[model samples]
Target: MVQDTRELNRTAVLTELLRIRPASRKQLAAASGISAATVTRAVEQLIAQDLVVEAAELVSVQRGRRAVLLDVVADRSLVVGVDLGASNTRVMLADMVGSPIERREIATPIEADATALADWLASVIDEIAGERRDRVESVYIGLPGAVGRDGSTISNAPNLPQLEEPGFLDSVRARSGRPVRADNDANLALLGEQHFGAARNAPTAVMVTIGAGLGAGLSIDGRILRGSHGVIGEFGQLPAGPLGTRLELMVTGPGIMRLASEAGVHLDSPADLFTPDASEPVRSLRAHFDQALLIVLTAATVSCEPEVIVLGGGIAKSLARDLARYEAMLEHHLGAAPRLTASELGDFAGATGAVVAALHEVYRGLGVDERAFGDLPVAVPASA
Candidate 1:
């Protein structure tokens, strides 16, 4: 019991350091609500473990002596984040403080074979890590599908069918030679927003990713909601207008292309539909998109009452110039729309969120209760 209490105090101090590093022992004690003597002992143990280091001293104005500031030795450990997309795979390495150190992107495997994908991922991990690959303590993978509750299997991934293969996660773990975790892409995107993007400090937020497909990431009180089957925000599968049962057929990039063709506007690609020189028929498709988006946003707002709804993915990113129109349409439908903003993280949102998830696992392994630390005040770099 005594050892447990001491470890708890140490974790408290360490968590505080992560939040506001380079803090004096006095500040850590005050921020953690632990007694000064306990803070001193915990700080000494952390320093001895090489997890914490003393930085420049802060001269006390009231007292003659200077106080040494403590900070986490971020370079001592690292985590890897991987985003397995329909077309590409992105891998990144980040330090314990969540700062990305390196990143790599490659074409996804052509074959829908688990072994092939694992080999490709392992190659990417090696390429990113270069010499420090072994420094990676854990790995988190974001997939564009419903991850099983155990984070070992993926289902309902039409774009990347290889993930459905049995023992896929095990194969990746064996090849990568590290602990591996997997989650739905949209869910991780929302977590990325919470930890390092626009939704920072937001208690509740929803991210609607509209691209070749449509999906959402819902968070309430800073916790992501993954349903029993790990498929909570598969909004694209929801029924909509006479077109089809899937809402993606109406609002996504491919949906826009289909709608444009039906309207007698033949475009080479869905991206062309957003060009300024788009035909009248293609321009008119915006109304359909507006209605479709309103439907999704309304459902999200009514159900979760999120503080903010973030629009992401290729289609939504292109519509940033027309945000006013989208907002007006949403207001007209819902009477009052939640705060809406475009995703600032672009395509890297899922990857960054995967890093955050890996960091959480690292914290747990170190006996740090992340919940007790509240939100950290780390400034996310404008360019990641």
Candidate 2:
């Protein structure tokens, strides 16, 4: 029990250091709420483990002495985050500080079976890692479907048929020689928002992604609420329309295109919806899209009562100029609604979330309480 207490204190100190690096021992103690002696001890152990380093000392104004500032050893370890979308797969290599060191995107093997997709991912990992592959402590893959309770099986993914195969995740693990973590892409996007974007300090939030298909990621009390079968945010499957069409069929990119075509607009891409000179048919399409979005947001609002709702994905970003109008409509219908905002991380939100998830696993492996580092903002490189 004494050892556990020490470990918790140590984790608290380390977490504070990571959140606000280059801090004096006194600052760390104050920020972490740990005793000065405990902070000193933890800092010493972390320094010895090569996980933390002391930078230039800060000269005290009142005294002649200088205080050392400690920070995490950014390059001591690395992690990989993969966002596997229906059309493309993005891989990011990040240092311990969550700064992207390298990033690449490849066409997703949508037509490939499980084994083929696994092999492709293995090759991509090898290419990205090069000589530093072994330094990768963990890898996280975000899929655009409902991940099973165990985090491997794909219970439902209509866009990516490859995930339906048994042992798909196991095969990826076997090929990569590293345990691969998986989650719904939307869930990862929400995780990304919490760690790196708009929802950083929000206790409860939801991200509704309108891309090739509609999905949501919910955070309740600062924790993701993955349902029993990991389909908690499969909002796309909700029935809508007079003929009982799935909600996604009316709001997603492809759905919008189809609707526009049916209305005689003949839109070639969803981006055309944002064209300045939209035709009458296109105007009708927007109205339909907004109505469908309202249904999804209303359900999310009444059920989760999120503090904020972040909208993401290609279609959402393209129509970002009109989000406020939708928010107002929602308020009119529900009396009060969560603040609606666009995702700052854009398409990279899922990949960033995967990196955060892998970092959490790394903390767990090091016997550190992952919760100790609450609301630590991810360090996104300016170039990335």
User: Could you tell me every candidate's TM-score relative to the true structure?
Assistant: 0.94, 0.94
* Model 1, position 91: C-alpha lDDT score: 77
lDDT of 2 at 66: 73
**What would you estimate as the lDDT of candidate 2?**
0.84
lDDT of 1 by residue, 119-221 (tens): 8787787778778877889889988888878888688787778888889888888988888899998888888888788788787899888876677889998
Query: Model 2 misses residue 174 by how many Å?
Result: 0.6
lDDT of each: 0.81, 0.84
lDDT of 1 at 290: 68
Model 2 spans with C-alpha error above 4 angstroms = 57-61, 377-384
Which sections of candidate 1 miss by over 4 Å?
A: 57-60, 373-382
